[model samples]
Target: MRAVEDYANDDDAAPLDMLAALFEARGWPCSVRGHEVSGEVRGSWAKYQVKGIWRADDRVLQILCLPEVRVPDDKLGAAYELLGTINEQLWLGHFDIWSNGGVLLYRNATMLGDDGTLGLSQAQALVEIAVEECDRFYPAFQFVLWGGKSPADALEAAMVDPAGEA
Candidate 1:
């Protein structure tokens, strides 16, 4: 793993390196593992594991968001339904639950184009979008898994604008 400073100094570093530097510059503690940069981010609901991976050939930056909780077996169906609906509402990322562990994750990506010059601001926004999307839909997962609410109801509640809160 290269130091974040190394990435910061090299304008021609790989996508992963640039992302790590950008994240570090913004005070996010990220470590480069192989080709991915991962860190922990705190959200309104819980802590989330965030990973950034760069596909050099594709000029893509993939950001993944993973929450700490696991979805119970009984709630798998509801969780899947919520993921589908919530994914539709999202503009930048999609929610998916792992089949093996029933763990929900949010994924989004930014295309750096053929030239592979990704601006610092764009990279930061890509990572930020993944985390924000996870925090936004996290309550729906709680509702389905623990509150025993239907997927539709949970999604509705999550989307609703609470009165007098602004």
Candidate 2:
């Protein structure tokens, strides 16, 4: 098992490259964006968006990564509360949330119901849920490369098949 600290210190670009390569290996198309967002109340927020498809469905999975420091404790708490509300409001097909050091990964799941208009509170909530879930599934989260094959396999092995080993 790998420590969260080790994974956290690993290069962000390395994972992005590995993900892109995985997608390419599977013949899936992808787009990656690394950007910084600044706001009056939020100061400066760094975010990376890895958007693409793994299957024939029009659905797109977006992997969001943000610095832990950018997410305040109060905001994170609020996000968790909102996540509960969102989960109650809509049925989540599938999802996972994981964190390494100060970075968090929110991926899986189909787009939010209703044309993706999951208000700020709800969005934050979803992120919180994803983070928590990821922590529960440590090293496995890091194995997810592209086409989401690794994640799918991990979920099936760890969650779906209760009797199976992870």
User: Best-fitting candidate, measured by lDDT?
Assistant: 1
lDDT of all predictions: 0.78, 0.35
Show the lowest summed lDDT stretch of 10 residues, model 1.
Answer: 3-12
Q: List, residue by residue over 121-160, the lDDT tens digit for candidate 2.
A: 3333444444444343333333332223344454344343
TM-score, one value per model: 0.85, 0.26
- lDDT tens string, model 1, 1-166? 4555555455445677667777666677778878688987777888888888877778887888899768888777878888888888887778887788877788887787778765555666777787788878888888888898999999888777677855
Candidate 1 lDDT score at position 91: 77
Model 2 CA deviation exceeding 4 Å by range: 1-106, 112-116, 139-166
